[model samples]
Structure formats: structure tokens, C-alpha cells
Target: MKDDDKAVYLGTDCGATTSKVGAVWGDGTVVSTKLLQRVTRSQDGPAAVVASWVDAASDFLSQHDLTWDQVHGAGLAIPGPYQRYGVLDKSPNLPDTFTGFDVHNAYAGALADRAGRPIPLVVGNDGNLGGVGEAQHVRGRGHGTVLLLAPGSGLGCAFVDERGLPLDGDTLAGMEGGHVPIPLHLLGAKPYPCGCGRTWGCVEVYTTLSGLPYLLEERLEKYPDHELAKSGKPMKERAFALRTLAQNGDPLALEIFDFQAKALGIHVAVMAMAVDPRYVVIGGGLMDPEATSDAFRERYLGVVRDTALPLLWPAQRTTLTIVPASLGDLSQSIGAALVALYRSRS
Candidate 1:
């Protein structure tokens, strides 16, 4: 390959509370990576968040002693409900300022100003990008669809076909599986309001970190003697503490984990029935084996399999496998880089 053909690509993953910036060669070797917290805050406003992304990307290039001329293109992944052209329609986890923001143009313009020339940039849904990363991770495992499920501050879902490409079409809409409704009868407790401002329950309300408190509240009266009920810590802290207890074999904590796993399984089963993905790759803070416990991860997977298998059509039961994400938190950024490389090559 010529020097020009050895171009590097930039990728940015802007999540609700944090963002990641990195550069990678066309062959997928990571050049540099940085994890930034509070880089994009709805409260800080959309423009500020976009500026933060550009600053982070610039820093990544500088740290590596690289220049825009060496970068063939850039790709960004953001929390969505966005247009194919990169206009964010609305993001449930993001602030109202992002409702109609021209995210693609803003990032491209800012980076171009830094580069002193326009750079090709592409943007897509974060979860969809994650699917691309996970698909790449499991490329040789088999030839079938892969479902990427990210359960963190919120829940996200994406699909990748057998070719390891995101299954996006003309519209950037249907993949918002997080907002899929949860039948009232399936929800044992009062429906918790979603970040999207829906009063009725959605899969997100029971699967994300934000939903833990509501789940705990329902079980509080039942597990009055449990440590979670006696604690006065903040909801986030309490959620972690509960996970710790679950890891140590506490009955109440185990019950909570079981409930969450089952709820997640229902959503996964629905997706599997609809898409019939060969692998379901689970990612994000809530499901990380390192963040929680290996036992927790195992138990969660066991429950998911137990809940989903019987519900699956008899022949399809043996076709789907639920596993932890191979890329862990790096999925989105790597996927973004892959997108950039794909675009540049095309």
C-alpha cells in the first residue's frame, strides 16, 4: 500500500454521560484512545457537547503527533432518534437542546476548522455502531445476525447482518428497542417513568441503572430486613451495594438480579423472535463482568437462557446464544472507526 493508502481514521462515541475518542489504522489497529467523562451533558447544552467531542478528537490527534491530512475520514456514534443525514430528532437520554441539532454538520465543521480543510465524516446511532463492533468481534464465530444490547444508564439495541454490517435502512427509527413497551401485566410493580417522559413502562425502565431504584422500591417491603432497604445511600450507590450483596450470595440481592435478568430476557426473546440473531452480545456498565462479578454475569446469562429458551419456538431455542460483549465498553468507538474506514474505502 502507498503512504496515502496507509491513512488513519478517527472515531468518536458520544454517550449520554461520557464520550470516547480514538484513532485507528485502516486495518483496525488502534493508534490512540481516550475516555472522557462529562464530555457531553444535556445540561451543558448541545453545542457545548459537540464542542467537547471536537476538542477530544483534536487532543487524540495531537497526542499521537498526527494531522488531519493523515486522517482519511471520521465517524461518530451518538445516542439517537436521529435522521440518516445526522440530524438528531430527539434523544431520550439527552437534553432537549439536541432535539433538532445538526450533529453531523457541527462536528464536521468544527473538525474541519481545526484541520484547515473539510474532512469526510459519518455519524450513526451508537447502538447500531456497537452492533458493527460486536459483529466484527464475532465475525468468524458463525454466519448469522448478531444482536447488540447495551444496558447502562439506559438500554440500547442494534442489529448486524451476517456480513458484519449494521442493518440500517432508509429510516433511522425502528431500532429504538429501549422504548419498546412492557406489558402492564408483566410489570409486577408500578410502572416507572422513563427518561423519555413516558409514564407507562418500557424495557428501559427495568433494564438500566436508573431503573434499579424502582425495582428495589417494589421489593423493599418484601425484603425489609435486607441491607438495601436499611441503607440511606444515593440510588446509584445503593444499586452498586445491592450488586455487591448479590455477589456475596445474599438471597434478596440474588432475587433482584434474577428479576432483572428475566425482564431483560423477555426483551431479548422478543427481538430474537423478530430478528433471529445468532448471538446476543450484552454490553455496558450494568452487565460488565469486571464491574459486577463473574458470578453475576453467569447467573444473569443463565436466567436469560432459562427465560428465553422455553419461549423461543422449539427449533429456534438451540439457535440463539446470549453472551457478554467481547469488546466491552470499546464497542462504540471501534465501531465508529470501522465506519470511517468503510466510508473512506468506498
Candidate 2:
């Protein structure tokens, strides 16, 4: 292939437990992809983790019968509280070793050294990139502004404008939607401690899997005959088991999902009021069909539509469309690649 036609970009999506690496063409077609588990061990330190990322990227190119010279640039999507420069201020899910680590420079330096040339790179929050990916998917389909919610080890949020570009600008400023506080009255009597070390309730604590244990305990107390409670499994195991039961039509499991859906709906409503987005895309394993079933999507959207309608007040609730992510779990990786393609061309 000619150099111009063969040109590709590298992208990485770094999560709490795993990292996804991929290479893609400028047209959004993925050339290669891989998942690296436990890539961010605290003992390994930030530099080591960053090295692993570079290794992954190089491996991806080799697997595709390409060379670093064909790579135009690289982009990264990471769980954050990070600056635009890719310096992690602090990550609740990441090891303490990553605090204040300049991940961008580390990856850029390592990759550049391997390629024997300078490489341009960009970094963004994983959730924000997911939003960008989804927004790009539906850009011309009548969706202008897009809001994305990622419920997983923690809750994540991001916004995109009419052109499917992130609204946070080059610095990625003001995109920390997960840390948005939830009213105490909205939460149950017990405190919902966030993974961010905050004792107070936040949207993440009540909407994601990590927070489901608290709600499960509340439900078990109310329904002593619940199958999950009878199993006596640990909190994490019980959470997964409950998802299975819910998919099987267990009443208690369904009830727990309803409670979670309500909380998520309320939060979405608040965000919609603020951003007035045309579409709200919910992503993450929690929303996948295998975890809870399509019914979870229906229930969650129903609550969002119903709750947000009155708040919108004469703006016509139909203006908003709440839906699941179109790109599914691959959104972040694709988005990171999109960022690289855009930045490299600029």
C-alpha cells in the first residue's frame, strides 16, 4: 500500500483492570485491537505501565503487518481526573503510584524512541472519548448535542457538541461529571461512600456496580426470601449473581434494578437540564444485554423520559432521546483513534 493509503493511528483505552489497544485508519475502520489485563499495577509504577502501553501499541502495528512509520500519531483514553496534558491528578480506581504521573509524555517519549521519530499524541477521559465515539456514530441522524453516561467500577460522564466534538475543548476541562454530588435526600439513610474517598453520596456510588451492594443489603432486609441473600455470597459475587437473577425475572432482582434505574434517571434528568443534549448515551458493562437484559434499557429510559419531561417544562420531552451506546464496549478505543486522527491532521 502507498504510504498515504497505509497510514494508521494508534489508540489506547486504559481502564482500572485492563487496557485496550488498537490501530485504525483515518476513516474510523479498525485495523487491529487487543486487551491487556492488569496493565496498571501500583507496584509497577506509572512508568512501567506506560511502557506496557507502548509495547501494546507496537505489537498491534506488527500484528497488522505495519511499522511505526505508518502511524500518524497516538491517542489515549484513561479513567480520570487528569489534565489535558495526560497528567493524572488522581484516579480513584488507579493505584496510588499513578498520582500526578504525566502519562502523555511517558507514552509519547517511549513510542517516539521506538519509532526513531517524534510522534504527536492526545489524551482524553475514557468516558469523554466514549461520548465522542457515540456522537460520531449518530452525528447526521438528527442528534446534535450528546451526553454519555458510563456506569462501571465507577460512573463516568461526557458531553459532545453538534459536530460530535467534545465540548471540553483542548484542555478537557470541566468533564468530571462522575464526581457531581447527589442530594442526600435522594440517597437512602446509609451513607454511600464514593470510590473517590468521599463519604457523601455521589451519582457513581448509587448507580454503578460498586454501589449495588449497599442497595442489595437494603433489599435483602426488606425481602428476606431473596435468592441472592440466601446464597450468602460476597458483595461482588452477589452483585453479579443478582444480575443473572434479574435477567431471569426474579422479582427482588428486578426491584433492585428499578431502584438503580430511578437513581440513574434522576441524575440523567439533572444533566439534561444543564446541557440540554439531544441524546443521552449510556455505556459500560452494567448496561450490556448479558448483565441485565434489554429490559434494563427500557426501564432506565422510561424513568428518564418520565422524570425529565416535567423538568423540561414546555420544551417537549420528545426533544431528548435516551439510548444505549451504539459502539458498545469499543466506543472508547474507537474514540481514542478518532482523537489521534483529528490531532495528527491538524
Candidate 3:
């Protein structure tokens, strides 16, 4: 453990199911991260959410025999749009109680109350933090630009620069890469309605877990021999079964992910054209750094690499590296800590 007298900061990721708190040092080192189940969830409201982080940080400090005086700053990460730094605009994952909430106003006072002096704070989107966390995982420096694409409930995107700081546009953090217009569709496929109410042309329509069944429907109808062709299972159940079959190497299932990888690759290529990132890290529920175990995901990511790489210029192709995020779920919390450390220095 680091010296107790040294300055420490709390970096937190307030995710949908759990809240993660990280103790961070000046040099972007995450000393420890504690995961706390957020009981009652969004119904608990923003004040309760802030209180939980304080209490969690307090518990950690007390347990380690550390003093609040060592806590110099804090950082928070969450999903959805923000009005500005420390002010949430709206988050579908969160309750309306946080709508238009001035987080900077509340969080500053909360941290100050515990530290017995003013403590600085920074707020950011989780996806942006993922990029920050991923960049730190890379060894050494000169990582000019790092881009992270997370395909989970939806397609989550994060962008970080050579300095290991998120280049979040307007500090909203969540770049909403999912809603970017669809650049390509394959295998005679048509637009399969998106959650954003777009009937056509949204990358999310292909990348999201929730929308998978619909995406599979059009393809499955043509292949009557596919086991899932006439399945009566619910959407979630069908999606799971389809993935299971894909893992087992079913032809139709394998074909589905091939199509998905292409669409995902196209989306990433579109982003690359806008912001040329040297590193592309893909990790989430779908992919990871080492993927020998999950054959389906491994193959899918292979196609992603094959598709996105050739789209770049021959010189750019050799420079661009596509890999998976090493830190997994904790990346966001580590990122939040890094953001706090950076801001405190400034």
C-alpha cells in the first residue's frame, strides 16, 4: 500500500447495477477499487447516489486507518448525457430525480463536508472513462490516440488522446457513437429498426444486445433449417440461444456474427476517418483481450480487424493497432480516478 499521509483521491463509476470506487494517486495509479452493490438503484436518487460514494470512500479510509485530509479530490463517471461538468442532463438508465440535477453543486459540498476543506471534483461519462482506463493499461508512452468500442447493452464508444485524457466533445463524455448513421449493410440486409426510433441507418441497430433478435429475424427467415428459425422463445432467450449456437459453430449463427462484425467494423472505420486513433481497444460483454475461450467472439473480432484495417490507407493501416481493453469493467473507475488526478494537477 502507498503511504497513508500521501494525497489520495476517489474515482467512482456509478454503473447501472453497482458503484465502483477507486483510490488513486497523482501518477494515474489506482491503489484499490471497491465494488458496492447499489441497492434500490435509480429509485435511490442522485443525493443517495452521492451519499453512497462518500460513505464507501469513508469506509475505505477508516478501514485503512487513513484520514480524510489525505483525500484531495474526487471523480465521478456515469452513463448518458450531461448538462456540463458535474451536472447531469438526462440518463435513461437513471431515474428522473437526477434530470437537470446540478451535480457539481452537490458533489463539491459533499466532498468538502468530509474532508473538512475544499476538495476538487470532476464528472464524466463512463464510455470516455473507459478510454482513459484503457490508455493507462497500455505500457509506456507515445500512444498518440486510443479508441475503445464496447458492445454491450448497446455500442459504447470512448476516445482518449496521447496524454491519456479523454477528448470528450463538450465533456458529455458518452460520444453516442451508437447513433451514428449506418455506413454499410451486408448480405441483402435492410434497416432493422433502432431503439432511438430510427427506422433505418443507425449503427446501434446492428451492435446492440437488445436489438439482436430483430437483426437475426430477417436472416433466419431465409434459412429454414437453422435451429432458431421457428423458435418461439422471448427476445432475450432467443438472443442467448443464438449466441450459444454461434459459440458451438452453427453455420447460421456464425454467419450472423460475421455480418455483425462487418457492420461494427464499418462504424469504427467511419469514426477513424473523423479521428485517427492509433489504438482501437474493443472489450465489453462481447469481446476481451484474450478470446481463445469464447470462439464466437474471437472469430467475430477477427472479422472486425480484417474489415476495419483495409479501410485505412496503406501507411495508416500499418500504424493502427486494434486490440481489446485489458481492464474490463474496472476501467471506468480507474478512468474516473485518472480524470480526478489530472484535474487536481491543473
Residue-by-residue lDDT tens digits, candidate 2, 253-344: 77876776667777787787678888888788766665556776677667655655666636637677777876666678778888788766
Candidate 3 residue lDDT tens string, 227-331? 677678765577777666776678877777788788878777878887888888886766643432466666888998888877876777888888877777677
- Per-candidate alpha-carbon RMSD to the true structure: 2.6, 2.8, 3.5
Better of 2 and 3 by TM-score: 2
Off by over 4 Å in 3: 1-5, 33-40, 58-67, 113-117, 171-174, 186-188, 197-200, 219-233, 240-253, 288-294
Model number with the top TM-score: 1
lDDT of 3: 0.74
Query: Weakest 10 consecutive residues, lDDT, candidate 1?
Result: 32-41
Score every model by TM-score: 0.90, 0.88, 0.83
Candidate 2 has what TM-score? Answer: 0.88
Candidate 3 residue 128 Cα shift, in angstroms, is: 1.0
Better of 1 and 2 by TM-score: 1
